[model samples]
Target: MAEIIGVIEQLWRYPVKSTGGERLDSVEVDERGLAGDRLYAVRDGSGRFGSGKNTRRFRRMDGLLRLSSRLGHRLDGPELFDPLGRPVADPDAFLRAYLQRPDVALAREDAVSHLDQLPVSVLTTATLDWVRRAAPSAVVDERRFRPNILLRTPPDTPPFVEDGWFGREARGSARSGARLTFVRASERCAMTTVAQPGLPHAPEILKAIAQAHDGRLDALAEIAMPGRLGVGDTLSLV
Candidate 1:
């Protein structure tokens, strides 16, 4: 049997797709997922999911934007944060300042207001290594997958293999005492290929995974219960 080794080393949540994510020391889990995960997304005037897929058409949505939770810094509350952590105007005003487009900002606000759930995504270290081995030239990181949790595991394990834990409870260290279950493996998209500052040649890495791994590279998990997760938490395969 594989032994329980370590706790979650990293925790991340992308309030908005294609933008920068927020790192947390610990978070609570619910049926949907880490609170405030993927709560809002940017859409075009046509209502299609906007992202780096059509950078030229959606250039304003390309770069990284910051986010915060509206519910008192707790994961259980709504995820509504200013990109810069400053109290700014409504979503439109803030986005207009950051993205430089009143039209785009208004569209984003409209899309976000109707969202039913947060878009919190998670990943594991094992999965990242798998991609790195397959595509040595490709740069793989949380930015590419945009996951909420980045759990560390044995060096030899494959990335996202623990996703089998979906529907099962995983208990870990005191900091990450929350219950977790594997949900699904995140699907790769063209965004993986986009080049950003401090990260170059990323698309090749994701492409390599698709060519080698049947178009899957990372996994997503849901929190069965709300709890704190931190570095050094012991992960037991219960």
Candidate 2:
């Protein structure tokens, strides 16, 4: 039996890839990750998706990082927020103006919507705390890492413990039937080092991970058993 590790500390959903996401007190977790997570993305003129990972195709990947989005509870599509935190009624118009590239348009996620390695990404506060030691001044917002679930480990847990979570089976609420099979360690990328709204430029973040943790910060997981998840749900590392 896996020990009762921790309860989820934070939940996040990225309506658009590479763009900032919305924080939630609770969320319905599904096999495809979170509901409406990475559901929308900005496509460039060539019909290629915009992502910080694919800078060659979308040279303005970092540009997309400036904006943020949340689900439109009352609207059919996502509600966008500009750099200054002002609501943008028109995302395409905002993208065109913000990116200064009229050729770009917002595209919803399909088969190609998965820009990352796994469906769900998991991280622990202990790991983040461990990472903070590398550069104390830089902002270490969980948003920068873009994880689906942020589990709060025990107060006594050591930092970077999530690295050991790899290749493990994590069980959640029995009603929700959630069990995540940790596939592999999520390697840090350039996106983590970028300076965004609340985060200052911290290039050393990646260097710290590479040097201190072998460039691994989180774990990518696949749903072994589908179930609902919410804040405060106890997760067992089986």
The lDDT leader among the candidates is: 2
Each candidate's TM vs. the true structure? 0.70, 0.92
Question: Which 10 residues in a row give candidate 2 its minimum summed lDDT?
Answer: 54-63
**Predicted candidate 1 versus true structure: per-residue lDDT over 2-35, tens digit per residue:** 3574457787765555565677776666665665
TM-score (C-alpha, index-matched) for candidate 1: 0.70
lDDT of 1: 0.58
Q: For each candidate in turn, give its C-alpha RMSD to the true structure in angstroms.
A: 5.2, 2.0
Find the 10 residues in a row with the least total lDDT in model 1.
Answer: 111-120
Q: Per-residue lDDT of 1-238 in model 2, one digit per residue for the tens?
A: 6698888898888888888888887666677877778888888878677787754444446667778888845225788888888999888988888887889888876666545678888888988887777768677878878998899998979877766778789988676678888888778888888878878778888888899878887878888877778788888988
